[model samples]
Target: MRLETEMNMLQAKIQAGIVKDETVGNTSRFSDANPNLPHFQDDLDIWLTRSERFAESKNWSRDKWSSSLSALLTGRALDCYGRLSSEQAQDYDKVKQALMKRYD
Candidate 1:
């Protein structure tokens, strides 16, 4: 229930174009420790939303972000596409677009 509320609040801030990344807190590690299970679009949306906020603090290059994000995924879920190759990962925008296309 708490997580749902947080996500909803974050989504509202995003829709409002606040750009205040401060509101989007990373309560979950969202790394190897926190693996998001992808099944329905709702689940995917949560993960993607988290990913977008997580991407903000990242100063690394796009490839690095992609690889970093890849490391956070698990293959058990049908929508989970394992780790992404550096080349396949490309830039954050491309990767995000692809993910949004698939899971949004």
Candidate 2:
């Protein structure tokens, strides 16, 4: 129920043009590059854990980490990533921390 409310609010924001649709778009800059990434499914912590493990399994470099993971984000998670500064967005650790904070 709480999650549904949040989704509705996010949808409303998108419709109002407050949160751009691009922020929640299913396609991302890195999607084509890394098609196997696990997407965020209304749970930041679980998504982050899964993404981190996926990154490790793929041996994704620190440089490519954030972009690769960003490909899988949607809804508020995508918005959180979009809100990051250019430098922060490039560092997976910073991106992770920011996302955890946003969802917390």
Report, for all candidates in order, the number of backbone clashes.
Answer: 0, 0
Provide the lDDT at 96 for model 2. Answer: 91
Which portions of model 2 show Cα errors greater than 4 Å? 1-35
TM-score of 1: 0.40
Best by TM-score: 2
Superposing all C-alpha atoms, what RMSD in Å does each candidate have to the true structure? 13.1, 8.9
Tens-digit lDDT track of model 2 for 1-104: 45554554444333222333466675333232363755678877777777777767767666776766675677778777677666777788998998889888
lDDT of 2 at 55: 69
* Model 2 clash number: 0
1-104: candidate 1 lDDT, tens digit per residue = 44543443343233323334446754434333222323223465677677655555544344445544544443232233323333445455565666666665
Check candidate 1 and list the clashing pairs.
none
